[model samples]
Target chain A: MKGFLRQDGRKGIRNITAVVYLVECAHHVAREIVFPFRDQQVHLIGFPGCYPNSYAYRMVRQLCTHPNVGAALLVSLGCEGFNRAALLEEIRASGRPADAIVIQQEGGTRKTIAEGHRWIRAALEQLAATPTTEMGVSDLIIGTVCGGSDATSGITANPAVGRAFDRLIAEGAGAIFEETGELIGCEAIMAARAARPELAPELLACVDKAARYYTALGHGSFAPGNAEGGLTTQEEKSMGAYCKSGNSPIDGILKPGDVPDRGGLYLLDVVPDGEVRWGFPNISDVQEIGELIACGSHITLFTTGRGSVVGSAISPVIKICANPETYRRLSDDMDINAGKILEGEATLEEVGNEIYAKILAVAAGAQTASEALGHQECSIVYKSFEPTGPACMPA
Target chain B: MNTSSPQLLRLHEADNVLTVLSTLEPGDALHLGQTVLTVGKRLPIGHKVAARPIAAGEKICKYGVPIGSAVCAIAEGEHVHTHNIKSDYLPTFERENQHSYFQPTP
Candidate 1:
């Protein structure tokens, strides 16, 4: 498929402008800036906290320079801790035009919005002029997450997605599986699949971090809706969720904002390492999705048994329904019905092939069901993480 | 499509329970195996069914891993779920007083 060529020699499957708010106070102005251009590829993302966080800054920077993003516009409230200047420099360095407006200095909301339109117009024109190059499966980075999970998830959709992940990794594409909170059980098995057997300790430690972090929060990433769908235990749920990583040995472990330097399987440790001060890690699925995108996932394969209709801004989410019953209830929102494996109709490989093809199609500029339905869902929260040792992702 | 029919799915040979592939009523028969059993109760598609009779406190295995323990004696083909099982790691987070699911013993 044809790829959007960025100035840094990286290929992008999409070319969209991102409007980011440095803090929550500038959200209104940021929304107004992208409101008129909503029908196009404009997505709004930001840090809601007023306090400065290196993680948030780095995450925003990674997202701003994502292959799918053509340019960025930063909105500041003039007093938040987010490093707006550095962020602007990062986006510009990627050879993408970037503009910023401080609400206090830019004559407040109305004037900022008016001038924001001018900047967006110019950014879009400049993005349209970016060169196009041919891209293959190897250039793509895919991530998987299972939500609204039920028993059918492990038996059907999750494994099928796993098979698809195997195929993608075999083709030299990057694959990421996350939500250690969901992986409460099955840490040993996961560590066993580490590319370097020595990396097992770090792998186990991350899951340990999730277990402790969740224990303190009085939750385990288990939502009320999950139990309603027939998942009796967290280990059962994890066994179901774990299949999304396929059989590939994990090349390394990654934190939410750490992009994979090369292609292979990597687990994102969403839990913070420090004391439990900031609330629960990843308040919802969108936070996980946002993290996946920050780490450079061009598309996410979202499997659901109870059915969740959420697509991401900047990245497309291909919904794979694990329950036939749920698929019938929300067929329009689903891209694949893996529950057919239980109905004695389709096999796992068939569904896996379908998912792989769907990824390719989505990467080729086709909007997923959620994207077409305008489900630009996203969320990012405060998190603290200690950098990994050299063994985590050896240079 | 009105084609959601009941079927039994066994993910691993070592699994002591089979996932109820579809919503099933009691007294269903199958040519499943020599462990010859029939559905003993109504069960949801995603719920678990005993592949064999499991004694009280026996580990309930799925995906070839011990997910929980049977609180009481469970007969072959009986619907194996919350009523009969308890998570071995941590309490299964159900809508009803659901807590955390634990990590496996390292």
Candidate 2:
């Protein structure tokens, strides 16, 4: 498969002009920069932390150099702790154009905004003429996450996404599914799908780690809305959630920022390695979207039985509405309706094909509903990990 | 017609209860393996039903995991919700006047 070859030997499916905020204080300026250039492939995404942490730095660095990004403009308030120079250097080394506009050095808001606009215009022009390679399924890295689940999720959208994942893996696309906290009761089934038999134990251990971590936090990721949607127990929800992974063998386990070396089906272990520290692996759906982008997913298949209208900061999010009634209310925000399967109007394979087609179109530069509606939300929180346990990354 | 065949529902093999996919009124017959039981109450879609007789203090199993335990004795095919079942971990909260599985129809 051909792609826009980056200096780091990575391939990009889309050429995106990224506007980044250096600190929470500079987010307004970054949003302003993207407001004017929201057309085409210009996207606004950044961490909103005036006080910098190592996790934010690592995530921001990886996200800036992500293959989907072609050019980046950093908005800094000048006094923030973010290492602007290091970020810019990393993007430069990856062969992507990057520039940092310091608010203090530029004399204030008006001048800085003017300079930032001019810099973005010039950077977009330089990046506009870059050559792109012919791309195929092999060039794609796809991830899946389901939120706002209801009873229909397992019967419809989740399984349909699983079918699509199966086809993607068969076609040599890198596929990933995450949310360890949601895999509580289905560990044995998940372990059976591991690439190696010995890796099965590691799979169970990862889910156990998530359960223990959430238990320590005094609240499971499960919400009251889940019960209203007919999910009686955490295990019931886990069984339904596990359907999104399909029957493909799990290729490997990857941390939040770890990109897959080989394309197959990889389990993104969203739970941190040690004791409860970060509060939760994900505070909300968008944060998980950010993590998927950091892991190099160019597009995401988001299944929602309860109707979630969220899009990622970098990649396109294809919303697959699972419940027939929810689809009726949120049709404008959804890209595909797998709920038809539950209504007996369509088969899971048919809906899966529809989702797959939407993915290709979105990857080819078509805007997703969330993207067109300007929902570029991002979040990164502080977390401490004690390192992988003995059974985590098993031999 | 498929008498010998096992019931197919969302309930895992390890589960002691089965989920109701459609509403069932009292006296409706339900078959699980060789056991045939009549509904004690109307079970709403997406709610749980007792697959076997459950005594108070017995753990409630779904997807083979203990979500909570029964606070009252529940006969097989009886509707399982806040009225008869309760959570061991959290307070049992209910939506007042809202339709529960026991209420067969609106």
Winner by lDDT: 1
lDDT of 2 by residue, A1-395 (tens): 34666767788876778888878888888888777887767787777777767667877887888888888889899998888898898889888889998988988888888898898889889887877777888789999999998766876899899999999999999998999888876787788777876678888888988888877765666766666666665666777788899888897877777777667988888887756765677899877878888888989999998899988777889999988778889999999988776556888889988988887888777889988887777777665444443343324
In model 2, which runs have C-alpha deviations exceeding 4 angstroms?
A1-3, A385-395, B1-45, B51-71, B76-78, B81-106
lDDT of 1 by residue, B1-106 (tens): 1121246677777888877677876776643465555666667778877778899999888888888789999877777777778876656565555322344435
**Candidate 1 residues A1-395, lDDT tens each?**
99999888778888889999898899889999989998789998888999998878878888888899899999998988888887888788888888788999999899999988999998888887889998999899898898888888888899999999999999999999999977877999999898896789988988888888878866677666766677777788889999999998899888887878788998888888889978888878898898998889989999999999988888889999999999999999999999888777898899999999999998888888998898887667888788866788946
Q: How does candidate 1 fare on TM-score?
A: 0.94
Best by TM-score: 1
lDDT of every model, 2 decimals = 0.84, 0.77
lDDT of 2 at A287: 77
CA error at residue A110 for candidate 1, angstroms = 1.2
Best by DockQ: 1
True contacts kept of 1: 0.58
User: Model 2: clashing residue pairs?
Assistant: none
Q: CA RMSD for every model?
A: 4.0, 5.7
Which residue ranges in model 1 land beyond 4 Å of their true spot? B1-6, B26-41, B98-106
